[model samples]
Target: MKKIVAMVILASVILTTAFAMTGCSDRVVLNVFNWGEYIDESLIDRFEDETGIKVNYKTYDTNETLLAKLEAGGVSYDVVFPSDYAISEMIKRDMLLPIDFGNIPNFIYIDGRFKNREYDPENKYSVPYFWGTIGILYNKNMVDDPVDSWSILWDEKYKGKILMKKDVRDAMGIALKLLGYSMNSTNDSELQEAKELLVSQKDLINGYYGDEIKDMIANGDAALGVTYSGDFMDLYWDESTDFSYIGYGVPREGTNLWFDAMVIPKVSKHKAEAEMFINFMLDPEIAFQNSNEVGYTSPNTEALRRIREESPEVFELPAYWPDDSIVELSEVYVDLGEYKTIYNQIWMEVRIE
Candidate 1:
């Protein structure tokens, strides 16, 4: 009788363990890839709690890096946040899957201004995320000058105190714009002129950097740096930083008006779950939280309305919300197709020599 009782208890424990393992394996997991420091992480926790889907979040610094990872194809990403030009290139390659709007009902909250643009004109493949301009962030105490033009970056007096983005298109675009050529210039002569301008300005550049430019500028390590407008606003308004000495500017020659958006990759294994996540992000409340935390202009009309109503000061600052004149001066990026190789080679030469 004692041996039978012990055998029954052992069987019960084995069954319980198997059931637990099966339950764990059955839970849905969603994989997301995005730019570093671009999202509000608490939203991820909230999403997991509400939907019971596990999130595996990762980040990359540049659009080029994001493209490379997707093309290499070892891991599958359910969702990716890429900029305008990159999205255009991916769509041409059929690397992204068309998002099902029926599953993303909250997309109606997206502002119309952000929709039907040159990058994804029909809004077939991507949803607008955050939109901002590329410009200069500077230390007022370190330099006394009208922060108005791209030409100031080349001034010999500020040499070795200026930092530029290591990004290829942005660096090249600045030179292109300064020379009165289109940022998307495809002509060999125009591109070469842009390249030559960058090469000439190399001596004045203290260093080329990425997201780290925020801290470096805030700490007064460098006087001036080229960065996204949203990044500058985030650092400038940070409670920990002394705001009186910092300033941001969009050059008179114009700049890239870039948009970053979320898209489901063709390699996604969980399309439905991905759509659910995208829909959740598009929710007005979630979009507001994300924009407030990240310091970028939200593309959701409702979210922007809430922000403007609650924090009216943001609208007063041109850096956070540029006026119409500035908007008219800005241009969006388009895929360069084969011309990208020439730009890449030019970027390589600029970086190496």
Candidate 2:
């Protein structure tokens, strides 16, 4: 009887080992890195459940931060979300892998206007995710001035109540646009002038913030802030927020018309799984859910139509879907290449000052 029991225990151990090895070999894990608060978390769970592909997700605040991590070369991310200029930089460095459109059948849902953009002209390496403009979000009760141009940010009257983005490219772009220069200007003298403008406005700036800027302005912690169109719209449409007292405007001097997209990194181990996830995100119903939850303008044409149909009031707001005139005035950011170092130096000096 004792011998029989020992044999049974050995068989149990062998079966457990076999089961563990089988599970380990069959499981597929995809690592996704994206902007903070950019997606609906529920969709991630749903994707995992449907595909049986476990997702390891993480978030970063700035595109620069995302670029740094990708450059650092230690960690591996299967999928990443980066803005237009950043995508250009990555493609220049051969950091991205060309996507297989055959696997992404839902790519048909993306709006034609968003495709073939300058950053990825052929639409080979990236998939358009969200698009918007940078602008001022101000509290009407706190400031009586017209918030039509970038110059209003430097007004002395709102001195201690002003906010700027902590992001280098965005803040610098604002200064560049105000100087009547292109936001993508690579001219050293023009960049220097923009830098000086930021330095001059530094004293008036209450603080430099990131995603928290939306909440800060919403809570009336600051009178005015430079923020994304989508960030302002998110709060504007929220039932809990007082919409009557807040306003958002794309400055007349022009602003950054930015596009953030998804790409598979060359470092990706599960390229197929990454493509699957990208395709899943592009599904019309899933895209609508994400766009509605995050309050960003979806690049998915079907999703855009759904939003307009479901929330016609959103389209009524100029800031939500700017007219063609505003589109003509706005400029998309492009890779500055080696000139990025100068912008970085200028930003550091402005912050330290």
Candidate 3:
């Protein structure tokens, strides 16, 4: 199985452009780094056309891989989209360049309810993008019972039919939640218990994966897999897709909340253009287009409203694009500093042993 951790860096190599900027020489190029296939590609062309500023679009599959590239300073990126805990980690490491809200007037449209959080106090470092949960994705046709919670993945009935995420943060987060502990639990004993659970789950798991879960679950190779909310949306192929039977839910104990945000990196040379791209996304029409095409929720409130109204098909599926069920259950994972090593160590044990 492909270890899905080096996601961000690998996608960058495939999608990034090396050519010099053509539209604005004085205005630096804005490098927008994110997970592969996470955004609407048309937005890139639109940004370039509107502002005459070139965008260097790149992608990463895993937050850790993205952070490694940021730390190594391999390529200067003007903007990055990382989740809540990752944004906090980047701020702590000083790898991000602060944004100037003056350049992004669209900041006003973002719901204040989502702002003023611990990761970026005063909304200085990052702007929230798409947010969602990690949960079990099962083929209703393949599974004998309903999959409304994390416990189903551990059921002996589903052994060898389960696919799990390779990342320690999300994989461990699920185990922690199932065991009725915090996804961000700091107690070493609680963590150890989660680790043990993961170790047993690993044996029953078909493979530990991240990006591939979409295809794996969709094609019926796996009945149920641990997956991101948005990934299941992307996997929806047709009526035969079995979404009617498949289910996604946070356990009663809840799962970690993931908030992807737009930020200017310290390596950025195009703060102005970077902010321009962000503002463009907040436009309701663009936000609607982005979410509809990309299979993730739009951070723009107006965009979400417009999307549900304009495109009923996008809203009428088990994907539950508009449902806030998971949002209420999310405890946005925060940076645990050096304790990240603990999760990594335990995850390795679960994978190899």
Candidate 4:
């Protein structure tokens, strides 16, 4: 029964029993582990139909979780969607395979800004999947004051009414940003300071969570929470107009600009097939459909152009893409290496508090 429920929720795409006998008699399977609810359900079925590749989809809520699974070395996956820092760590650990761009002709559609990024400087280990900034999502009716700074989360008036991210990097990154420190700070003293601040705010927080924050905020379970830009947009606009009371903004103190990218694991047996899957997703129509369903910024220029031309109104929403000022102020996290153990210890202390 648990397996049935898991299949229903994750919506893993298996070839229909009939298709297994017909089109997929010799099907190749592509195992994908990604963030939950990050892709369009229809796209999985479509990919299976067109390519005869069976998708065995799984999801993990945090980059750490993904890393742990890959490191543990029990299961094998063809492709994974990991954030920028995770990709950096994986490359350093020799966990990923270089992408063969020749098999991915649709790579030309990706925006130039998304290419040759710091995480995979040579574009060898990863392909940009979705990109966004971290920000505060608040209920307009519940919060009376201006909501433009990271300090608002620490405000005594809003104590016990805040939702904080459960993930380490994001949670500590917020504290670091609040202190005017870099989110990717390697300085031990600075990391310790952020840890102390997070511990101090533990009592004020309603709970720590992952993607459930979207539903929790929309349903009024919490007045404000730190969330990805795309999650805020999906909840505030796409989910229901009733959630119009919700607002998203990158704090004046700045935040993290994050990118989740697709990569082939070194252990993957289906390298060429994995490249085929990446190329298929980069097609303009498919990319557009994913952007619309997932409510995240696509790295594909053609897809974004089509979206803007079709729905001129989305541009009015600030959450679709942030202003240049915010983009300039925001920073991306890099592999902390040995310093990550310090972060883990600090994060564990915060959780206990």
Candidate 5:
């Protein structure tokens, strides 16, 4: 993937010089770092065609991976999609550029519910992209028992057929929830308990994956798997496959309500273009396309209205637009600071064991 991205960047550089030499001096390239399969690829072409800006896209599977790349300072990215807790961590470290809402008039289209939230109380650093919960996606035909709780992941009957997320937060969060604790629990004892549970259940895990969990679950490779609610929605409603029988459920014990938002890194050299890209994304039509392709809930009010008007059935799916009861039980992750180290250590111990 790194090699592929490097080739794209090289080609962009060559093309930029070519365009400039040919009198197209205003052309620009926007470097976007986001989660794998998080965006609608068609939108990139549209953005470039409309704005004369090329997109050099790259992907990371987890927030931790994104943080590591940023901290390493090996790459320069104009825009990044980090979750709520991640955005908070970057802000504290002065790693993000405060967005100028002036340059982004389309910010008004974002739902008020997502604004001034805990991660960016002043709403100066990031803008909500997609938001959803974490849940278990089980194959209805593969599992005979009810799948309402996090404990289902540990059922020995499904040993070697349970897929789990490679993400530390999601994995640990599941164990924390199973033990009746906050997904963001910083208590040492509580964290240790979660760690122990994960380590003990390692044998049952078929693999720890990211977006691939969707295909794995859909193809019957795993009887059950953990994934973002939005990803499950995509697989459940996928028209190319027989996924209509799949089932997804939030644990009765509650789960993480994650929000992946767009932010400009301090190292970004294309702040104006980055903000332009963000503003373009906020356009109702663009937002609608993205939400439709990614199967995530859009935080754009106008986009939601358009979706409701066009495809009321898709808009009404609980997996796409969850009810208040589920929303009430979900908690967004917060910056754990030093506690984050503890979580990483515990996560490492589980993986190694």
Candidate 6:
């Protein structure tokens, strides 16, 4: 769900059946599990062709869902894409395996700020895929005022015209931010206040959604809602000062910048092949194609340069060309354990209210 500002690279396939005869005994095929529309279809084909190893492309909606499936240990998958906080949880549970950085030399192209992040300190396990901040994406015509703050979501005049996400870490995380608490706050009272605010504002919502928020907004089903920054470009509008105006911003206090990264699962059968696929994605050409196709930021330095050069138009978008204040926006989110439960309970209260 972190893909509001996401994208990936392309690759050619390589199918060599050396010690990889059986999916169980040998690791011939690499199963990649990630979010829908998170990668380029052409890249998958290229990976299959270049590796000669079968590429099993799968998708999941949330990090929680992906973690649950992996924890069940019912399937054999080599790699997975998970958000910043979820990566920490997996690392603590020892569910992830350390990467052989030697196999991923293209990783050298990544930006340093996204590397060795707190959740992935030393970045020994995960590699950043795409990242984005949480903010309200609203139609400029409907919003009526500048939307540089989170308090606007609670305005009474906007009653029954908002769309909020069903996910706790996100929707609730925004609610917490509006209360002037840390996005990573562990305080019980601060969380309780956020819960109350959500409950009060729930009725103002026209709908609660997940992936459909884009289509809904494009069709004018709602005025504004909490959304990932990456999804803002696709919402809806016309050539004129027309159908809608898509705008996004991190709140004044700050916002959560979440990154989804590719990681190897400890139970993977194709560790080597999985690493190859990751490196293929790291290739600058692949990154350029992936970023251009997906409309998200590339953590790959070289790929970003290509994107800026060829498609100067991509740079003109406000969400893509974030304001200087975005630098002030902090990198934070609630942790994995019990507070997760507290978040879920508050979500339920907001939903049922």
Reference-based TM-score of each model: 0.82, 0.81, 0.80, 0.79, 0.78, 0.81
**Model 4 lDDT tens row, 27-138:** 7889988899999988999999998789999999898999999999988899999999889989999999999999999999998877888788899888899998888888
For each candidate in the order shown, give its overall lDDT on alpha carbons: 0.89, 0.90, 0.77, 0.87, 0.88, 0.78
Query: What TM-score quantifies how close candidate 1 is to the native fold?
Result: 0.82
Error of 1 at 88 (Å): 2.6
Clashing pairs in 2: none
Residue 236 lDDT in candidate 4:
51
lDDT of 1 by residue, 1-353 (tens): 99999999999999999999999998988999999999999999999999999999999988899999999999899999999989999999999999999999999999787887889999999999999988889998888998778998898989998999988989999999999989889999988898888999999989999888877888889999999888777766678756768788888888889899999999999999999999999999999999989888888998889999989888766578877677777789888878889999999998888
lDDT tens digits, residue span 1-353, model 2: 99999999999999999999999878998999999899999999999999999999999988889989989988789999999988998999999999999999999999887888879989999999999889999998898988888998899999989999999999999999999999888998998899899999989989899888887887899999988897777777689746778889788777888899999999999999999999999999999999999887888989989999999887866567877676777888887778889889999998997
Q: How high is the lDDT of residue 320 in model 5?
A: 75
Model 5, TM vs. native: 0.78
| lDDT, residue 322, model 1 | 77
Backbone N/Cα/C clashes per model: 0, 0, 4, 0, 0, 18
Candidate 6 versus truth, CA RMSD in Å, comes to 11.5
lDDT of 6 at 11: 17
Looking at model 1, the pairs that clash are: none
Per-residue lDDT of candidate 5, residues 1-353 (tens digit): 99999999999999988887877654677899999998999999999989889899999988899999999997889999999988999999999999999999999999887898778989999999999888888888899898778999999999999999999999999999899888889898999899999998999889899889877888889999998788777776577777776888777788888899999999998999999999999999999998878878899999899888888886555567766676777678887878888899899989987
Candidate 2 deviant stretches above 4 angstroms: 1-24, 72-74, 155-160, 192-216, 219-221, 237-244, 344-353
In candidate 3, which residue pairs get closer than 3 Å at backbone N, Cα or C atoms, i.e. clash?
7-60, 7-61, 8-60, 8-61
Off by over 4 Å in 4: 1-27, 44-76, 192-216, 237-241, 347-353
Give the Å error, residue 283, model 6.
1.2
Which residue runs does candidate 6 get wrong by more than 4 Å? 1-27, 48-52, 199-207, 236-244, 334-336, 346-353
Model 2, residue 238: displacement in angstroms? 4.6
What TM-score does structure 2 among the candidates reach?
Answer: 0.81
